[model samples]
Target chain A: MTDPDRVNALDERAAQWALRVDAATLNPQDQAELDAWLAADPRHAGAFARAMAANAYFDRAVALGVDRDIPEVATGIPEVSAEAPRVSERRVMSRRLWLGGAAGAMAASLLVALGLDRLAGSTSLTADKGTVRRTALEDGSAVTLNAGTEVSVAMKPLERRISMLAGEANFDVAKDASRPFIVEAGPVRIRVVGTSFLVHLSELGEVAVIVREGRVEVQAKGTAPALLTAGDRMTVPAQGAITREQLSVGEVDRLGLWQRGEMDLTGLTLGDAARQYARYSDRRIVIDDPQVAGLKVAGVFSTSDPKGFAQAAALAHGLRLTERDDAVVLSRK
Target chain B: MSFSRERAVWLGRNVFPHEAALRQWLSARTASAGLEVDDVVQETYAILASIERVDHIRNARTYMFEVAKSVVLQSLRRARIVTIDVQANAQFLEIPEDAPTPERVAADRQELSQVSAAIAALPDRCREVFTMRKIQGLSQRQVAEALGIAESTVEKHMVKALAILTNAIGRGGNVRNASSSVREQRDDSETSDRSRPRERA
Candidate 1:
């Protein structure tokens, strides 16, 4: 075959491979085949690269609504005729308008329902393991629940109260001076007129409060009420004295990373990181050796991929990885 | 150097838009440098794709132009018959400014129409499959179910669509006639296969 013909054949094969790669995860055999093909010749890699780039390029066609209507010819010249709007454009505009109106009407009705429901009794909000959920209260306050967390909200005409039953949650309390917003976790109570803060109830009955905005009055069982402003993190232990610390804006942002499905494992030991991953996924990252568990890990990792985290940890610490049916075990190599 | 989805997306958004300008620049020099413009483009893409990371590439347009220039230079060197004028032209090649010019802005706006035309130029079955997969965002399995064809057939159509569209857009969008001829030559067996009811249970 001629050089151009060979090149065309190579490109066609490359496109086939590129499509397969883009379509879905390749099996182990197909992956090996692709690896071999890529290593066979340098030009094969070049053609494959071009095909992959083209695959990415054409992905932008979705924005043009090309599926809905195809222009007869591209021509690179703008159409000059100003006739009635194209069918696709008209359809999109009407759909958007109808959606907007429907959403507005639904929200209005939802507010009325929530107001009546809140007046009746408390509402329990629970986020199961491996899920983060956000609930908007009738008072315009919003609460974001971390994985495996539960909070029950009881709002009266005079006061708004939330009971943090387990795990952690961030509260963005709306300003209602007449009705003070109160969050109760164990023996500690946080009262605020309007503020945003995170309340975490640990397994040992320790309540940690981090104020992101405004001011909150935190009162523990045996201590005087303490005032916490923005960037203040106060931890009240089950049977000890309360401790308070100031956090930088960056640190506060890092603390709230779980809301975005991320966990900053920086400065955390392998053992602690494993426990953190448990909140996001059932797949356990088990480290058998105490020495291996004590090894400090640093980096932000996705909360969803516990196995990936285990693998990286194994690689970094030079540990033997054992993938069991329900757990990823890491031991000293 | 390894391939990554993030890098592909970065190239698609940042670098691909400037292909026409790069092609125009290369066309002016390819005559004297003894280089094929398409070969240079493929090589440039290869280089971009193999890079370890794209975070360091602050300006994608300039980086792509420079990469294409180096591809031309590498080819000219391999040929071993580089003219002094061609060498001078390659060395003194002025990359377009980082900011989009008025013409570039207009061309950018016309890009959607260009894409529409490319899709329009595809064979009937090929176009439908491509549209459903790329535009309507359906999985190959879903498309097969919707079209009452085999999943393999959907994949074949996708592969053909990508090959044709890639060549057409790579040459700066005079793709209608070129794509149709190529489609006819390549899709004969697949066309017959598509006609048969090979539905999966």
Candidate 2:
């Protein structure tokens, strides 16, 4: 442990040391040892700071699944380009209204905003793609859509509002809990206060609401609003207002597969989850075997390919697959 | 009370609620946060789980604290990588057609990938703090509270991460202006990291 190997690893090690200090208050002698280590090398001091920054990254990434993004071109350490780091910091904190510990993304996003991300305004509904579009309506405060989704905004500064119209989105509605950030999709109207929530909508009219790290308030157009928590989920039928109930923590993760872009299934009917996973992929999974579709299959597969998804599913669930020209056929062996 | 139960109770009194936060902080602080904490905590618990003798008094809190710290220290000696620890194989194949290609683009890509893997393999705590400040955008105080350490600790972690990152950058030659090339590849690599489904996408 003393060799401390490479400098960056050493810094990372130092941060882990600090995490030890924080995980439980360290006794005096150990504390002194840490102090002595810090005092030994100027490089060590530098590594310690990097270690903190790294921990911050891990914390934020874990909280928000802030997938590690490597920009095509070097953008020189993602930092908010806004003139005032102060404003960006406040905006970043407020936006925590989105990612659970998703704050890391906020910083990257602000860099996008100040660097290239465009902001929005006035519309009660807004959908921003690959951008953190922030808007300050005369009456309501609003942020736009996530990575790939699209949305519209509307507002007269009196009745602030927006709609998910399409794709997954998170909202950090301004503090007028009375005038909530409501998304009117099909027949369901999702309302929320000074809180964070994730909404997934598609052309099929399917709407899903997931809460990662905080509380959320949900209500279909004709129904009353319900308060949900970290693992809570609400699904509205594509056509009907009839909403489903709460799901387990494991269930949210299953559904979250698309977001993570990695999924695996096994020993179950392809008819069950394969059809569900097709949502995230470019190609489609057609269940040719009506009965075999119900047959138990298993493996680990990337959600990106229904055809290839068989690998992961096969590995995990023991389902065999036969891929041929024209289409990938899955039959329970 | 049984030794293990007593230890749990003591941890309950000391850790709990913030236990997740502290662990989260520790995970953030340390590289391999997920694996390291689980391993050490498990070992500590296993040892406690097997013990027939319980330290009667003096607040099992100190014992638990000491053990966890010792675990962290012992953990410091363990090997790093949690994910598929492959060195960066960042080929230019997936780079969008519109991406910039300097004469040395491929060479630059190789260097950057090395730097990134080096960053990922950093120790738990330093990686945690480095991630927080560089990526998560938390202030020193927030990181301090969340990780359960001080602002000074957070600063120390950052300094360490930078030194390592800079040194790694230096190792690949031309460390001084390496980020210039880093700046060029900055905009589009987001989708390139882990889950690139060339298998489909």
Candidate 3:
């Protein structure tokens, strides 16, 4: 190879090593290989160090909110709600048409009225990372928010509306046909006369609405609305198709298990199950290999125990779970 | 206690002890990479503090370093490293320690605007793919399905977007002060890549 070509190859190898080491703790074999590569030449260490430092540049940007792409409206807060129409025209226009028009007016008034409620004068309730909160509204309805969940509630004599900005929540609505309980999350909204249901706004913008009792109508922009009754579930993928399915007895029992800090995965893919675990904990389960993510997993696991989940997933799928750095990485056995 | 408060307390008891070592370790690598030590430290703290169950951390010292190392590496892989000079653009990376003072908040607003401008400057396809991935939190498969493109193409666009932003931020907004050496090398490498014939995936 030419001198420059050789240098380029070395740099690429060093960058790969930097990525590998950062991905997870290397086993003895891998560690020895990395050590050998670093020891082979003085320039190798320099290249790896430089690459690591370069990586740090991106870290600083994220730390400073430079790479944050989600607009304020997507988060379901008031500051961006007023100006959201102009900015969200391209992406959220369809959902906004439903959320910001007449329905939007109802939501606005509901929030204002709820804001005036005697309890703490706060209309918003948020569950922090690794925490679940159960709150009772003034109107006798109860709502349970999972970890890392946020919802803004508004209530009026005519209607009760709750906007879930992120994460998951379970609602036990007070039967009042005069005041339909509407839960808006991302692109999907669930309107119920008075039913118990779970709304999970996934990180990928998908909305999963699981009904425990009664009936609720699930609506998404540009798609036909779906009517779900007791023991029914529907997942609306972002800007795509809506899938309706039945909730098995096991699934029904597992509904809102997060309230008890338990993760009941009934035939969920490893990746989705890991995401569910991540919702309840700060530690992330990184499927180092994509193939491993597709492995089917089912069990009742602890929400606070991602490591345990990883171990169980690994054991079940004939994979390996390596506890490394901040993330537990799962890989092929 | 609130989760954030409880987290803060847990982090104080477990992760805070290693702050000096982590700071020193990260600071030594920042100059060449064009990062502020404080920013790196803050990012490290944020990662550790966000962990849902601190009790699972068998060794706080090792976990803290692991979090810091992974944060740096993850940031790099997610960020695009172009030939921009970011050292002098200190205002963009300097965040107030923990609490944001009024002045610091104002500065952050300015920095956010600049970052938005940078995002706006991304190539059309790259920006779209990036928005879908980062903002909308769509998977590559989902992005491909939505855009009517191949998943590989989406990944490529994301890599390109990160490259553009990372390089731009690395330069820290001062176009003139940006280091030319890295840019020259990148230009050379890109030229070579383009000149080479396409290979099948």
Candidate 4:
């Protein structure tokens, strides 16, 4: 076995090389030396690859706005009360984190037998902009609600019924073959015995479903049910045949990133991405030109900061951003 | 000999075994040119392998980079896209007979998830500092200012974060057989600290 110190030294060197490569003002001489160091050994090359990959990972995560989720204090330091208002803010944040888990165990006790004895009472959940919530169900399963989404769950002895009133939600159904879990979203109805899947219901009746694990069967009125396994993404337009496509692991991973307040726009039009941002921010993003709306964009962005998104769009596409009191407008420079 | 075998032999014997550095070089250039790095690498490999007199090459590594640069230029010219510098073409002697090949684009997709996971595993303060500097693309001073910490503290956090990440990722894979060789650096002063599970914000 190789010495651990030697490995740490290699990793340290590799990390330095990665940082240098990404440095804003890297000279050619530095590049030449980095290349030389890499060429020196296969091990060096491997370590450097890991380092670079880590860098790219952070690049993507930053774009996705994943970094904004962390609290200011994080874990390394003591929770100091130097700032008066921020101390209160931290308390609220910590309280939110504490309460952030399942709306609570009290949810089960809130069940009244007013409904049919065979049927468990229903619970409705709604998540506003920038608020993602995970709530446990009576049957040991759980549902994670995305921002701007509303879901109502009613479990009967024979069937588990979930109605997506608006927006999107992911369901992790407990295994109960006797009681099939059914999610009704607009024109589509998804049935599963036990599986985790996401259902996105648009106001226009367009529905999209992505299965994380196990199998789910999706159906429309009078149409044959389509079987979607893990990593399957099926999009049903307001009025058209349902389209099914296989999603790469990266693509599927993106689907659940919203739990961390990440907005994954792997392939979205500027208009669509703006709408996604609107779901999180009170300040709306408005594209002044039709051409700007059609511009394709892909990256992760913070949902809570529409101005940041506008600024990024402006910098990236050479567009002009005019921030109004109510909205931020994007147009050609 | 097959082109791949010959090229592999040449790479093993001649070039500085630094695949990571080569890829890094290609990635930076390609990102600016709005081209995929893998495609450029593939093109460069084809040109280098097809050379009739590989034995006559002096600096194999520099020659490969030069050929790679030429491939990008040739591609830009053929496509009628002048995104790169105009003086670039004057620097190359021969443009290989190659067309842009249709290939899958998500070659390094796994790396994103791996890195994200590793970031999630980092200590809270370190993760925050590192994410601000790397992900947010903030300068060290900017990160220090934003967090109300000293610049030196930010740098220390960055170093700690980088060391942790490289150790984790390097051991996991991509630095082949690095698992047996690597160990997580212990910060004796910080080991007493308790880490909270990642909170969903």
Task: Assess each prediction's global lDDT (C-alpha) against the native.
Answer: 0.66, 0.43, 0.55, 0.57
Q: In candidate 4, what are the lDDT values of residues A110-187, reduced to their tens digit? A: 122111222257878788766666676777667778888998889888988999999989887888999999999987
Give each model a TM-score: 0.43, 0.39, 0.35, 0.44
Give the per-residue lDDT of model 3 (tens digit) for A1-333.
111111233334544554345434458898888766654433344344433433343333345666555332232222111011111111110111111101111111112111122333338889898766666677667787888889998887678889999999988787888888889999787899877788999889999998877789989976677899977889888866688899763465466556545665657898998888777667789985778888887655557567756765665566876876678999986
By lDDT, the candidates rank as 1, 4, 3, 2
TM-score of chain B of 3: 0.39
lDDT of 2 by residue, A247-329 (tens): 65445544443332333354457777666554543344556768756755533233434544443344334456666553455
Docking class of 4: incorrect
Best by lDDT: 1
Off by over 4 Å in 1: A1-7, A71-333, B83-85, B89-92, B97-108, B177-201
lDDT of 1 by residue, A213-279 (tens): 7899999987788999988999989887788999865577568767545577877999999999887
Any idea what lDDT model 3 has? 0.55
DockQ each candidate and list the results.
0.12, 0.05, 0.03, 0.05
Instruction: Give the per-residue lDDT digits (tens) of candidate 3, residues B135-181.
Output: 66677789899878787677656655544453344334422222243
Choose the strongest candidate by DockQ: 1
Q: Indicate the docking level reached by candidate 1.
A: incorrect
- What lDDT tens digits, residue by residue, belong to model 2 across residues B16-56? 21223233333433332222332333333332332233433
lDDT of 4 by residue, B1-201 (tens): 012333434543343233334555655454434444434443344334333346534344545555555455433332333433452233232222222211221123454454556566566677787878876679988999998998767765675577566554534434323333222212211221123122231
Candidate 3 is graded, for docking, as: incorrect
* Cα RMSD of predicted structure 1: 22.9
